[model samples]
Target: MKILIDINHPAHVHYFRHFARIMQSYGHETLFVSRNKEMAQRLLALYNIPYMDRGKGRDSRLGKLMYLIYADYQLFKISAAFNPDLYLNFLHPYPSQVAALLGKPSLVFSDTEHASLHHKLTVPFATKVYTPACYKLDLGQKHVRFNSFMELSYLHPNYFTPNPAILDVLGVQPGEKYAIVRFVSWAAAHDFDHTGMSAANKLKAVQTLAGHAKVFITSEGALPTALEKYRISIPVDKMHDAIYYSSLVFGESATMASEAAVLGTPAIFIDNDGRGYTDEEERKYGLVFNFTESNADQLRAIDKAEAILSDKDAPQKYKHLRETLLADCIDTTQFMVNQALQFSTAHPDPVMPVNS
Candidate 1:
């Protein structure tokens, strides 16, 4: 089988790299085409991921519109040449649409059910739209629902193991307490801007938390200079390591916040709209806590963190929850790959190219 995957973000790279490897192992060929977003270059170097760069334009509205147009054109050209047996991607509008137009099977993996303006136009065209049942968006078909989240495939305990070596690389020493803080711009088509935490709120939370643990901050935009006074450390790109060993995680980024919770690192997520798979599923499964921006309820979260930190039995509790969650969820990557391959074989398009 031949597969073409279009990745739009650094998180997508991490999430899909394992899937690409899995496909290759099954005697399939894979090609990745993606936006040259923030972590793209480094990810390519770190993972040896081969990708075609669809460079970003400026950050203005006009620039974004033009970039999308260019990206579509590039995807069309790439798909024409590669003629992939199957098109598998996260939630790409133009790329997936092009694949469908080519009469090829397009499997769109998404956790968001809330239809973005873009999805309103493109989702109906996809052959399969896989989503977590907690997704609030209505895709108007049974194929749109998937019981599993993308995180389960990779972040689940079955596949994920914390790298102590990565801790060493980050210069983290024993007994040095630290908390991970993540902030995202949420510039996607979703109305996620409501989850924005002000600089004052972050400093206030960090000040309170830092009194108990070292604070490490990571954000899509730059951190406030005032945060530097508190000795907050934001590593250039060692986010996974920070989350893996953190005393706790607090964030507005739905994805990373859930990653922390599922990894059994207790997390507090404050979002205007809690719409991600991890946020909805983790809380539903009682593995994590979520707060709306208006509620801003940190009291219970703070108390929970304090208890978890000082208690001798906290790690054991986390371990138990992690194990329980893992047992209940399906491996998302294996399920997605198997389904994609099956779809490809059953509906091969002669006009489409398969890498091998």
Candidate 2:
């Protein structure tokens, strides 16, 4: 089978990389098409996955709409030539629309329930929509719920093992305490009106956490001059390794928080909107703390971080919680591969060509 996978974010690369390789081992052909969003292409290269670049995305509403047309054209041209039997992506619109036009099955995966705009544009054209069982929004008959987090697609023990050499790279001793803090650009359509940590709170959180542990910040946006010195300088692909060894993770990114939580690190997620997966991580596993962008909640989140840092047993406690989480969840990469192969076998018809 020939599959066309679209990547819109760096995380999407991780989401499908393992599945793509395993599919190839089973004698299937896979093609990746990606936008030049932050680290998406760079990561694809790092993983030795060849992909066609669709071009950089736009942040403004008008620009985004225009880019949508441009990206669709680019992908449509590529898909027409490749004649893929299937399409796959992480809640992206371009592949879904193109798949509909070309008459192919597109399997779109999503975990962010609040991405209402993305859902409207992509779900209708998608042949199947997959989401974590914790996802709050319902996407009608096409929706399929999985008993696992997307992070597990790559971070699960079956696929990943943390490297301790990241400690030397971070200039830390084996048992030294440190924190990973993330800040996002907030330019996505879903992040439209939502906010994360305020400038003041960003400083407060870092400063408070620094007192208990060394702090390294990673931001998609520019950091304030005062916080710039703390920006992390590790290779992009090594981030999960860094997170695995960190004492804590405090961030505006639900993905990073989820990554940390699954890696057995305590995470504090600060955003105006909470994700269902993060909510479950907090409620079911006690591995993450979720806070709103409200001033009170932000402060409370910082306090919680400090409290967690003070507890010397935090690592052992969170690791135990992570084992519980692992036991309850499926290996997402395996699940996705099984689903794709099953769907392809059941639908043996060739994909119809795109109309001129």
Which residue segments of model 1 deviate by more than 4 Å? 57-62, 191-195, 229-238, 279-282, 295-312, 346-356
Weakest 10 consecutive residues of candidate 2 by summed lDDT: 347-356
lDDT tens string, model 1, 222-321?
7788775544344434566667777778777677766776677777777656675756646666556677655345444555555556666655676577
RMSD, every candidate, angstroms: 4.7, 4.8
lDDT of 1: 0.68
Model 2: per-residue Cα lDDT over 88-181, one tens digit each: 9999799999999988899999999888888989999999999999999889999999889999999999889999999999999998999999
Maximum-lDDT candidate: 2
Pairs with steric clashes in candidate 1? 83-353, 84-353, 113-137, 114-137, 195-272
After superposition on all CA atoms, how large is the RMSD of candidate 1?
4.7
lDDT of candidate 2 at residue 147, scale 0 to 100: 89
What's the TM for model 1? 0.87
